[model samples]
Target: MFKTQPYPHQQMAFDLFKDKSYFALFTDMGTGKTKMLLDIAAYKYNKKEIDCMVILAPKQVVPNWTFIEIEKHLGIPHTVAQFRNPMKVKEKEQIFNLYLSKKDIGLRILTMNIDAARCKDGFKCLSNFLAKFRCFLVIDESTSIKNPSASVTKNLLKLSRKAWTKAISTGYPAPQSCLDYYSQMEFLREGLSGFKSFFFYKCFYAITKKIRVKQQTREDEDKPKGFGREVTIVTGFKNQDKLTDLLDSFALRIKKEECLELPEKIDIPQIIELTTEQKKVYVEVAKRCMSELAEDQEITVTSAITKIMKLHQVACGHVKLDNGDWIDLPNNRLETLKNIVEELPDEKIIIWAHYKKDIENIHKMLGESSVTFYGDTVDTQASLAAFHNDPKIRYIIINPKSGMSGLTLVESSLNIYYSYSYNLEHWLQSRDRTHRIGQKNNVRYILFYCKGTVEEKILSALREKKQLSDEILNNITNYVKEGMKV
Candidate 1:
């Protein structure tokens, strides 16, 4: 067998793009798109068609490309370097030196953080590397460059001409409107969208309206001389069919269900390791969680579940300290989630958490590519609209109860429960949100649970369709002994 064999659909994708110099992979996430790209890069490299390959991805996923994906999928040996902004001066010098050295490297491969391209140093490093070799530049999650005026997009567009071949990949091609396609497609090739500039492109697709809102800032209120800025809102789109037809020329559209045989639902459990401090706190919580089982202690559904909820909170890395203060213990939950995200294929994903803090942390950890749907999410409707329409939004962090009633997230094929809810209805409703109508592929649900913690019990109860309060009544006293075995 090959080092990493491609599925039949993946092999077909590889063959279609292998010979093309500039083509877009519109394949949905989790369909082995990355491997297909790597396979094609390997094939062309062996034919001496390219001297180097540059893979640009988000900063959070840089380690994944350098360590995991490259090794598993590509059979060839490559000297990989990172062109990111956060690296120390010394580190950049070392990587730059290696890129220039005359080593017996089959291909001078580099996986750079796309956000770094905004800086002058990051842009120059990759541009200089591109100048030295006949390189193929591949942009994964290409919607990152949808904004025409973003610094990174400008820097990348300037360097796009240096590459011998260019490709952009994304499951969502037009997340907001057809107007977003101009900037992304412009990177694939000059005039690929048959437009000279973004303004011209926007004019062709969007009905634009610039409205100036009244302002009362300190200066404006005091002097009454300054005017508010005029912001242009896309009133609506025009001639979408024309734009879609244009995209069909270079877009390779692939949906997961059309190509792969998959079950209706796949459930996977993510094991989380607690930090030393977390373990210490967890032990304390566990002791109190079942104290009701003692000879003199009284147990009730209300009291037992409340204690269990606190234990669940501790497992999520935060807890309420006495004296009405909140104490956040050292926890690895967020770190574990980041690791899981790195392993997933580049695709839109839904993340459900029971706590608001978990939702916020998850939103922050994933950076600008994520949106949270909860009570305090400002302008909840607008945020939900973006979650529904924005291609750049790859992760949606949702509070099950808040998102359960009437929302559809079928754009994503994977759903992850960062933590569980005791409410059976919320849990089941969240699971169905991504698997309903408009969903073309099977949905995979990955639930993260801390073994030997309250989460395990909740997950067990939900899985067995047992009331958590009843489940606790049966084993609350023997939780330490009968339950919580790793």
Candidate 2:
């Protein structure tokens, strides 16, 4: 019942979990987890086990499942509907009602962004559908619900209880900590982690300590009346063996290296010399951040992140002013990117940038030779098709957050990071877009950063966190302060 032949690893994963009621695919990016999920759905549909399938994924990824994945992998005749907007309640209900009225024996597939589940209308619509049909629910890139406190996570957990079967899929399941596994597991099946609440789960698996610090008082508050507050911080993890045993029971964990003989992933750091204007702007932002840090005895994480993001933005050639306007600073980074593009005229390249302005600038520089995949791109699937099929379209400019997960771009072996965020999950998932199965040539990753700027500091932190698997943003204040020294 499969349209495409599965890889050996994919076939094994399918055989193992096809009949399971609840499971997780901790498969590496570019390893065809999507195909495995579709194969399972097809098997169940053929057996008359499920009347429909509901896939909840990131906004950009939701479209691809309907347009590309199911069309490529599933052999069954199915009716597919994509819920793009959460505000269109009436339209969504009509689609669901149409599906309910249909008496066809074919599988019915509904795809929607996980964020929609948080909205009242979207949640009610999906709830009603689940109430009527026996659904095989899947959450792709399951990390979106890793936060237990998020409204979307809570709503999904509740909705998951309605499905006949469920699965969660992601390349990097626990990006920051073992704590990330808590809510994702709970979404698959409540108390899957052996703990009912995140608070107790954290206490069981995380080694934490409490420290007292002077609390920040409001400007109008009396300073003498302020008291210290004790905060609990995770020092490390515990019970790893038990957690591994639990996950191994229901999760198929596979890495690219273990299952596939993929090409080498070579990382190259391309250091650029900042222009006079760029250097001046970067230094000003760094110094201002240092001064602010010096003045604030207790800086909130949000304030620290904003200050660091300002410095990183300046390093990336633009700065957002107090009025929310972005002014470009003269920088050699774009010129360097052009030079690299010219040097590889015939090669298909993927250029990743953090900002929309960067994607726009790169798109303009490449002109007709480039297609863009970002949040603002009107037709992401069309852009993806052009990149995959057209030889003349040699460049794909993308924002990592939007184009990072659930994509296979083996057409390009070279990926240039014009800019990137501090999120390690984005870095890892984006890198695998070209390096996954079917890649013949060695994958080359080029990272661009300005010397003696926040860009360099950000790269350093990313490297360290990539190795350590720690949260990079937790140390943003230190990165900003060190950038000023540089």
Candidate 3:
């Protein structure tokens, strides 16, 4: 028997997954959810309890699982397979056969982006496989299943029925509403059982609409048909400790603050002040946008603002210029990032960007000394190999969507989010890439945002959403109504 030493939190998580058929690991960002999950898979495989495991995540992250997590965390030797988009029936048949031969393999891990699971055939096949072999289905960044209306979310509910055990992992579960808990809890089969009866369960925490009033024109009246009543889950840090003891039977969660003996972090935004020339151009562009708006023409002010930010971003030297393309700017984030990493000891650092452009810039700045994983790549095996084998490679610039979950980059405890995206789920998962398992040192995560711009506003809104601040949401509503063009 290949025995593996478990981190305190990993052991706790493994224990929880042992008995619970449906559960959640609401561990914070930088917690070791990925390693905990693999440990659980190993245990189940050893016990012959499950022949396979399916990890469903965002598209940006699916590749990382195949290339990184399975290799890094599953201490015991295990053969893993990947499911690529089947362009032909022949490929589908091959995947089908691989899925059917699950029992023979000690632990078969199939990773797919949540989008793949939403397709009718994909859902049906997954459902069939689960029914045939008792499996463990772990949803990394489980909030993707938060919405009931989304096709993927619906498919997850349907596909999850086949799993002998179901687990959801997320850092910030309700980044929007306590109602976010409803679908997640439902996924766990906690109280509500399933989605069809969710409305009935909702009645327990929501109030019904009783009246409606029209605007002064008496033409349109917007009235709430149902409003949520305050419903709080009494689980806190204390209960979490108790829950851990119980989870020892099946699941584990590790917080970076509690377990990792990492370094003190200094997270500072290296603001790239716009050059005078760029500022002049930006102001002119903004003026043009406003002029277009005045003429009742559709203008993506959001995109326009993004352009201004890009211009400032260029001033920082992060932008690239190609032949016959628009003026190529440079990425300042890379320079600041290089300085930050140079300050650290010889250990490697993980750099996350929301765009491929940033990845290109980071690549150009770092040169052959660095490696990256993004959308436009073949030979996935080669990319992973380069990263794993090269000891001197100091930085790995990754697209957050592509590198966040199911990847183990724990060699370095320092992670920097160069830019942010509105997708709370991706941001949460990206931080954990370096914070999860094998990290003996404490980890520091830095989020860089340009102050006073729409970027900052979005970040503020997201943070407030996590707190479920109705006042903040109301203010945002007013701000959007006033400034947003329909």
Candidate 4:
């Protein structure tokens, strides 16, 4: 039987961006954002419509789109380049050569980190190119634009007027406060022009308080206090069901859970065959983690496993030492994770890690085949697109702090916890990447932990707190509603 694909919700995202002037596809992460973007690009290119498109993204993931995500999903062939190393005169010349005459090339894809975009030459060149071409500009994970003063943000808006189309894609655009929404919505041209600045938007949905604080009653000072006004917390995007209809006019968006029917849990283990010397250190670390960390600590299987995972990190080569510095050890966790991914039987998988060091090391090990979105990859939309693209990615190593909450990674059922983090919020959001309602498979989380450590203790505490968190959230929602009645 032919499988029915792209559940209704996903199809809607695809249709929403077909012809809109400016809009955003705020689908959750793990949703099929990458696939939808590919389809949109292909549909436009095939019609001989647009000559070129530029996807701006964070540095870490710019490589993912050029090397992996685009090739894997789009039917159209496109030339892609990384916009880093622009300071090198030779590299700049090469990039210029690729950008020459889009009429000859179907789509000239350029990716630059947000930092480089802040430079004078980078901003000028990008602005000039967009002004010359009939282009579609997409900013993925658009929250990076929330800071109105950022040069990249200013440059993007300057270029936006020249583009025939513009779109923003984000999973959680407003993670912190309503104030975050102003700059994002302003870039999308979704907010009122009269409210031209972030301050104006903040004033629209915020209350101010003047306060003076005293230490030992020695001094008093006056300062402005900001409080959130009644705002809609869109756990999902607004009018989600109608999203596709809206996008068909300008762009397309898809959720992974709603599209690809894959496995629920992917169990991958990086077998770290320790060198004889490293093994000795690993055993010692494991012994200490178990006895000292878990002895007085109330532990569960999950917590015990988590501690071992941290101790394993010490063995693998990288560990956050007590003094806040990360030390390199004789460990192979990074390589092991890659090996486990390499051996996977050709299925989609989601790999989660806790630290930036791990993310970069894992990226090095996995090569350009995978997409990474964490703090390192923040402030760009292209990285967001790479994550959403339908690609044969071996791993998606992310910091729970950055990759968690706002995204949906439900495209692959096999979730591998290569390492654990300390934040309960990040843990919950990361797990939901696979365990959300769109999933049809029995989801399983395979965690790799050392035999013992504080990491394990943290994981245990988070697990217990998770249940309590749900209750607290529910209570908060009710409280907010009741207060609104007054």
The top-ranked prediction according to TM-score is 2
199-237: candidate 1 lDDT, tens digit per residue: 888888888777554453566554333256556766567
- List pairs with backbone clashes in candidate 2: none
What is the per-residue lDDT of model 2 for residues 272-385, given as tens digits with 9 covering 90 to 100? 887778767777788888787776545454566678778878888888989989898888888999999899878999999999889988999899999999888999888988
Ten-residue segment with the worst summed lDDT in candidate 1?
292-301
How close is each model in CA RMSD to the real structure?
A: 16.8, 2.9, 7.9, 11.6
Among all candidates shown, the one with the greatest lDDT: 2
| Candidate 4 residue lDDT tens string, 109-200 | 66676566678877876787687777777777677787778877777766677877677776655544445555655665644333766665
| Tens-digit lDDT string for candidate 3 (1-486) | 215466676676667665556667778665666767777777777777777788887766576677766786786655565565553777566556667663555576777767778776667667776777778888888878888778887777766766887888877776655456667666666444333565654454444433222222323224342322332331222233432354343324446778766555445445544444544444454454345434322223243344334433433334434452445443345566777766875767677776666677777888777778777755544565677678767777777676655566666777777766555656666766665445676667766654434445555654444432333232433332222221
Better of 2 and 4 by TM-score: 2
Shift in Å, residue 116, candidate 4: 2.4
Stretches > 4 Å off in candidate 3: 29-31, 38-52, 59-80, 87-109, 190-254, 284-349, 377-384, 391-394, 413-417, 422-425, 440-486
Q: lDDT for every model?
A: 0.76, 0.84, 0.60, 0.59
Relative to the unseen true structure, what is the C-alpha lDDT of residue 228 in candidate 3, on a scale of 0 to 100?
27
lDDT of 3: 0.60
User: Could you tell which candidate, 2 or 3, scores higher by TM-score?
Assistant: 2
**Cα miss at 2, model 3 (Å)?**
6.9
Checking candidate 1 for backbone clashes, the offending pairs are: 175-389
Of 2 and 3, which scores higher on lDDT? 2
